[model samples]
Target chain A: MFAGGGKTVFYPKKCPRVRPAPCEFPIIGVPTGEPLCTIPSGYRPNRKCTYMDYAIETNHLSKNYGQVCAVDSVDLHVQPGEIYGFLGLNGAGKTTTIRALLGMIRPSSGSVQVLGQPVGPNGRGPWRRIGHMVESPAAYPELTVLENLEIARRLQGVTDKNATLRVIEQLGIAAYRNRKAGTLSTGNFHRLGLARALLHQPELLILDEPASGLDPAGVVEIRELITRLAREQGLTVFMSSHILTEVDRIATRIGVIHKGRLIEELEADKLIEIRARRLEIKTRDLAAAQCVLSEAGYAVSANEDKLSTGDQRAIDAPEEVATLLVNAGTPPTRLAVEQENLEDYFLRLTGETI
Target chain B: MNTFIASFWAESLKVRRSLITLATAGGFMLLPIVGGLFMIILKDPENAKNLGLISTKAQLVGGVADWPSHFGILKTGMAIAGFILFSIITSWVFGREFADHTVKELLALPTPRTVIVASKFVIIGLWVLLLSILIFAAGLIAGWLVDIPGWSSALLWSSFGSYMLIVGLTYMLMPVAALIASIGRGYLLPLGWTFLAMALAQILGVLGWGEWFPWTVPGLLSELTGPSVEALGIHSYMVVFLTFVVGLSATIIWWRSADQSR
Candidate 1:
């Protein structure tokens, strides 16, 4: 079962009823008339499908450094085939959470389970099936790109001799294969990091900032590669990034973390509906528009050169707003409804302004 | 075993590509070359003085010019120089991971951290062993080239046995350097520890307690202070062995349990 939009949507195995009937359970994010208990036609069961719960799961996980709370009581659940975008500003404990998930750091409290195995006590976990790039890319500077990945392949216990070449090609780093890792550019360096992470065809990938240090084209290329891998190979990705636009573009599920706490978790599509929308009317006389909207029971505020309102009436019927403004001798020059973007939503939730 | 092999291969590649390997080899080779130079100076002091090799006040450099003296120089040099050089090798092998920020890559791999640490130790061991061999082999060639009088095979085998024992004792102390490198997460701390250990060894040897101290025991075994029969006992070797065990265990445990934020 998966939780989305404050409602639990059961997968096929979790549904109590055998026959397909109208879902008695409340449906929030699921489309109307869509079968609640049927698997998608393209869904193929893999080794990770046996877990059927979460690719990564954490409950009230917390970590501290002396008196400073690095990560506090954070809960995360990332389903298989879902691209979970962990969004936060710098020093927001995004890396701490990733470290805990990878068993690189022990949690001060609570537990973490990855690939259905508990993490830590002694850095023990299902690491063989998980690939990760923490903080930044790192490699033996003396080794070539091919040599670095070859070492990674061997350390990962991958027997296939061609795994290194496969990931190198997959990541479009074939051109720099023989070049020493220390000499690569930042974008190619990040590609090498991703190549190492993807070398073993891991079931889950935990990347700290997958698109960081890449040009716009490189970012788009990586985005397409990740999306393709997730769709075609059923790989789960848990990535943390401050780049809201990149997350907005690719993440199936978004988790916004602020000051070490996970403030919000929501499906990407549902974000479009949940984010606040407002109607803005730019008129010759902003004061007159504000007065008219306020008098008509529409809560309005003057913002710069425009009168903005969150009133449903104004948003649902923009022509009515235009007519009222026209009749009030403050005819609208421009009027449109604008939905808040992820960045705005994040800032607003965190009580920050940009 | 398979994981160990893979980790060993990875570690070997890192060492093979590093300039430190060549640098340490060259550094260790200096001991034999200097010893050879000292032998040439000792063999003909007046001629050496005429050639401006030694000052008039520095005419005597202890023992007579012979194979025993050359082998003695090699043994004592291994005891002293080997401590510094082997510590450097150990520090580089362990500390470079943290310095390069590649420790994180090793931490979460299928090959257990223990195996990786073991592979690092093994690489350091093999590297230092090779350097010791180079010093001994070069010392033999230098002795033959200088034409020192004493060339008895019996004395050569006995000196060789004692030289190897000193090398082993010096090698045993390196795990402490490894441990310090791991805990400090870089090269500086272990190198600092090495210098401290050397100072303490010198001070303790002067204070007449060298036999009990692990750092000083290797020097005593080399008979640099005096004859090993009078300077050391069974307890000295035991202390060095204990230091090795403690350092190796602590390093492995630290790698296994510590929070690797890097």
Candidate 2:
């Protein structure tokens, strides 16, 4: 759906596909039911855009083993050049969904589509255009890092032999290229896994727990690399991770899954919008502070050693809360506004509060 | 074709870099060396007595010091020991992927899972065949060193044919080990399967039903106890062939259908 009714096509003059006449645009389906812009034909088309603006789309995708459902009816839409962070706890169906998307497991019901092609039975899909690493980083322990990547590159149908060398340098594992994979440290092993995923210069990268063993610096490096791939190359990334802060920092959009179901999905900016913030106050007489804030029409509760209110009025004006507590003879000892971080939000959503 | 080549290369590299390769080679080398030792022990009874219990055991095991008896030792060794060694090779080829957790990396790729599985089988076949040839050559060298009597071109040709046939039959049974390794996803189950098969082969062969059982066919053909064609027939070959087909098809189906949640 590139052009709407009676709307003139807006073609960029500098577009590489600009011809002497007019550039032809194809009408494609997007989940949002809106028209999408067109890129040059030779350029990697929006991987997320087929009939929809989604590189990966699933409808009622569910997988059950015997009586237990590993992945419930989950709907996902990952747009091109957008890093969609799948946040979940362990056994939360993140890996199951990733496996289904890659066609590693047959869904008990529903379907999955990637890069505009349905993932066929027995793990057949548009794999040439998609790169992925599921679960743990795995390599032939007896083979060197370079050898392992060379295999991945070849199996990925990459013609250039130098791709292995390029990815090795790109992941900063050049020193260990000649070292056997079994000898690598955990972080470097993860880098080798990432290098393998990026070996074919795929348009879509699906990774599960990609940062599991990386140190803080390595995490940052991978984040920056993913960000650059999405920004500069228009790559689509669908990644799952338990590390909420890491996902929050790099993902354009995030989906939280709990107990084999997709519970929540939102833009990264909206994470702050939904996160619960509060005005917390400490006083000599907590009950008195609670009464005073209650009298001011703010819903207050006594929690542990303090009185807290989740009202925006109290949060925006903590000084007013302090003054009200003082006039009521509570004499506030401490008063401050606090906001919940992504981890807290995630924990609360998953009903695993700390 | 490109994906096939790539997958073949990957499987070959893993096989080449593995210690199992050298380990299996060294293990098979024992067959010829032990055969040569038996010949030396059988050559002279007085010297054999001076050599202690080893000579007595060799005399009991090997009847006479000659090219026929020596070749018989080689044939019997390949038939019996080949089962264990070839099963170990098949187990390592398939099981090591799961042991190393590298199977996941192989699951979703431009190369089909069937191609990867086929490449592994091809590598195993080539490796087992090469080892068979190597051990046969070693046996010939050992026979020449011992300078056993009854050496003739006709005997050599007959012995070589027998050696190759027994080795082939042993190799034919190894795909079952591959299937077991794939289903069990590690070394233990396949090794267990090999031992169980060997035990059952012995019992079945003793029960006078060796021809019908695929595992017993190799041992019967090797004729370690003496030529007893009454317990075996042409159906024995058919049974072994069917077992191979079944094991191979089951392995491919498992790779294609099983949920690789691990």
Candidate 3:
């Protein structure tokens, strides 16, 4: 059934701020003729369509170009008000999955539903609520920054004229508002792209490398902006990035895909918890330190100039290793424990060295 | 209706801001100005030669200096040069989205992709029609400035009809340009197709089979190659209409179903 026109089915547990419809069920968990909450304003939710909890849900979604599998049997469930970071190496099917999610590309096999509506055979989806920036941010270079955002705002069916101005200030492209987009710096161009995505105040923001061309400060600003939106406005963000640090900073949950398969999916805290930790002890007497640590029953190895251990005991008690080294007359120059960062963890998971 | 309005507004702003709009307008106006200069030369050939305005080596303007001659020049220019200009406009209208990599932005909006495509076609039609009117008006001004004789309401109305018919035929052929722009995903391929079609139109027109070729239909209707009635038959229009439907459907289908991997 087409969205926005059908018999009401099921009850509404938490009604979105839709047009109030008189209901015999007392507006409790029943789908009404009114628009669904979390759907962008222009959309008309099919009342007969049952409610779905997840903002984005996919089942066994696979996309193959010829014999090469671009995405292989991926199932994803992203809840509302969550920031799900999609991580992958270059050519790792992150983009393919994103395109599928946006209905920009068809799935070779399987299904995708966004905001409870099936995605495209002809660019059909819950697009009103979904603002996406796929791959590089492409704008009509001949147009000014403001004009570009205005276009986005109108096409996204945003009736508010100030929406474009708000996003321009938010993305800090106000200075370039009147300048042709082709002439903007890469960072500003990226800002303009982001501004366009944010113009409609969407419930879901699907960004691919959203910070690709930004400077360090610009990257932090974007990170903060995304974090604020998801926190304050209850927005859902499904962003794909190869920049591990960027994902680590903002992503609440991380899904790592490699060679067209999702290798791991975990909460950010859980990812940190599972990352390898090592104790490194440096001394003037490296040989003496190694022997002392080895004799102390720590699984010690040499990494370049320092003696390191993957032993949990050594990691848990760096003081113990330090005391042993000092008591052996090889006073430690440095002693510290280091946990794997997202980059190291990503590289390790992808079977690559730092 | 709302989506169409929004899409149309967006499409209009892009065209209004582009340098191509001004460039095409300037290029289109040259037809009338040149044709008027030819009328002046033909009006007084001896005086033009003495004044170095028309050298002895200058080519003849063919038709006598009158309203019909002026209208004929305008009509023929609309058919020949208008095709290229119209193709360029069509290419930019559809091709710029891909050239600028903005097609993705348009694809997943609340507005349907088909609506967006239709809006572009509407804007393209309006833009070309506006240019046709501008050129025709410029032709009138040029004729008045040249002070050509033999003007009458009947001749004027008939000329207007012929001019419009020629332009309508040219406009019908633009969908092929839109299709090439879409499938090629940029301006170059469509522009290349335009040049190829123009070359083929000349070849086929010379070979006495121009009536069947969609690209040559406007040239035939212009009555520059032969009598309009003989140059075009009922089947000629059918072929043009078929090309329009096929090109338009192909563009929409490509937008609807093709993988937008780019």
* Number of the top lDDT candidate: 1
lDDT of 3: 0.83
Candidates in descending TM-score order: 2, 1, 3
| Candidate 2 lDDT, A1-354, residue by residue in tens | 233443322222123322222324443323233434444456643333324346788999999999999899999987665699999999999999999998888899998988767895475888888888898789887889999998898888889989999888888999999999989999898989889999988878999998887888888888998988777666789999989998999998999899999999999889888899988888888877777778789999899999888998888888887777778888889998888877888888999967
RMSD in Å for all candidates = 5.1, 4.4, 5.7
TM-score of 3: 0.88
The DockQ scores of all candidates, in the order shown, are 0.69, 0.69, 0.63
Report model 3's chain A TM-score. 0.84
Where does candidate 1 stray beyond 4 Å? A1-52, B50-61, B225-229
Question: Which pairs clash in the backbone of model 3?
Answer: A4-A45, A4-A46, A10-A30, A11-A29, A11-A30, A12-A29, A12-A30, A13-A29
User: Model 2, which residues run further than 4 Å from truth?
Assistant: A1-52, A283-285, A316-319, A329-334, B225-227
lDDT per model, in order?
0.84, 0.83, 0.83
DockQ-based class of model 3: medium
For model 3, the stretches where C-alpha displacement exceeds 4 angstroms are A1-49, A172-179, A291-297, A319-331, B47-63, B226-229
Question: lDDT tens digits, residues A185-259, model 1?
Answer: 988999999999999888789999888878998899889988888776667889999988899888999999999
